[model samples]
Target: MTELDLATKAPESDAQEDSSVDSPTQSSPIMGDHEHCVTDRPAPAGQGPTGEIIKLNDIDVYISKPADYPHAPTRLLLFLTGGTGIKSVNNQIQADKYAAEGFLVLMPDMFGGETAPGGKEAYVADNSVSLLEQVKLKAVEIAKSFLIDMWLARVTEAKIMPILHKVIEAAHEEYSDAIKHGEGIYAVGYCVGGRYVLLLAKGTQEGGNDEESGMMKAGPFIKAGALAHAASVTPDDFKNLQAPLSLVCVENDALFTDEVRKVGEDLMTQDNVEHEVQVYPGVPHGFAVAGQYQESNIMDAQVTAYEQMLRWLKDH
Candidate 1:
């Protein structure tokens, strides 16, 4: 199949863990979008997570603090997950990496407990299935959750933003003094998670979407935000951006298409917000985290996106 074949379906966020290993993979699924190509195979191993999952107001948060720095972190970062949610050990591992760099990272479980059915796999260079064969596979898998799109649709800014606000409010309060010494709060999101990062940038000083969306105005959380391969972004989402943003886009994506991306960037420019947009050619959606499970080229691009995103948060 062609390189883009894997992402031709729904947003590819169905990554699963090697359940046989002793980890949180066996736990019940929760909230998140299926915006990445997923497979049944166990993904690449990350350095074992150094932080424990702590329950905070019904949300399971993976908190990682700086190593030797006793003062505030370099930045208090809220790591919004891809569709994989906190179930993605890789997301936790990524957070730990940020913590090692002297950033306090908070990765919360937005997915209460709900994983996607898996029949497809990552976009590995080794896969040689014919187009016909892959299509047939997707058809059968679609039967598993014909409402997959509807299910994904439920994770809207209105529905999930409050949960995010709760997470940030509680984490910020807990890390009060140390956070004050830091560079304030920043965020990075992957896949559908990217959409929320943008919303965080656009949110009110009370935090979350407009009160017209029926959410109570919560405390402010995000200072700046970054996202990669964002999915489900509407032009209206960009109309009132309030924070700095960095976007690492891929060349090909069905959801975060060029037109939509242009609209968002143009709006950001019109709003005179601090932002940066770069599209890495030849990669598809979900390359930031999901690509690490694919071919070496994909993985390399993913690594570059990581470094650029980190720099954006620290220096911006």
Candidate 2:
């Protein structure tokens, strides 16, 4: 079905609670050691003193690129951070995992800073605001508020798209492309980053034009996107997605639950699109983050996820 036709589906009850009833910090241990696969790497490619900056709305946007490699794959993992933002403790671990797997990683700071206000205390805060206020202002707003969507437009504006355009352009400008396909880019996004990746796959630079055109014309910068524990974009937004897509939902993920599943399911029926949904048993939200640094089913899930993504990227 056409995307416009697909977009007409009514939005769901924003009233549904996505928070985990059972705490992840309190989960009992499982068999295998799942500590972070990556250690000693810098936090993402930027967020440091001397990383490259791409200015979007004059907001000193940071874009991290892995150091020069003779045989770098064309794939790019554009990470979108969760509540903790880009400097999150989980990022280093995931970046290391993707880099080790041979994908050139780019962790973009969608949020201006790291960590959200009130921390996890909001979960148990009783003297706090009403449930609707808590969910709207804190939960949904923190993830994909109206402003963030507005920011997407700015990224696509004449001045901003060029910056992001240059970032992707420069990557291919210097890579070998000897592995997998000669010229194809793949993406994996976690949490907020997961939703960001779909926006990326649908098209780029907010309006779904400029950056996508430039990147695609530049040398096949993106072919497919995979979202893990994505809680940002609603199913209605799935209409924007065009490239091959994969949705990963953790059994213990507090963010994107069964309601999120219905959205992904609806998108699966679209033509010329390859979509798959995988729910990892007992895995938590930010499972990739946890898997990279601790013991859990996380690593297996990530490996399986990436393998599926690569297979799709190559075939599509």
* Candidate number of the best TM-score: 1
Query: Worst lDDT window (10 residues) for model 2?
Result: 29-38
Q: In model 1, how large is the Cα lDDT of residue 310?
A: 88
- Top candidate on lDDT is 1
Question: What is the overall TM-score of model 2 with all chains considered together?
Answer: 0.56
For model 1, state the Cα shift of residue 43 in Å.
Answer: 3.9
The global C-alpha lDDT for each of the candidates, from Candidate 1 onward, is: 0.63, 0.45
lDDT of candidate 2 at residue 95, scale 0 to 100: 57
Candidate 1 — what's its lDDT? 0.63
What ranges in model 2 sit over 4 Å off? 1-68, 71-74, 118-166, 169-182, 203-221, 252-254, 290-316
Query: Residue-wise lDDT of candidate 1 within 1-316, one digit each (tens)?
Result: 0111112124435242221111222222111224243432244564567787887656788888787655433567888876666766666777787888778788887666554444344222113555454445445445534556655766655667767767766766687655576646788887667777877776453334543333356423577888877766677767678888888877756656767777777777888988887778776466676324545776788789889898988875
Cα error, candidate 1, residue 298 (Å): 1.7
Model 2 lDDT at residue 75: 51
Tell me the spans in candidate 1 whose CA falls farther than 4 Å from its real position.
1-42, 69-74, 120-136, 203-220, 290-294
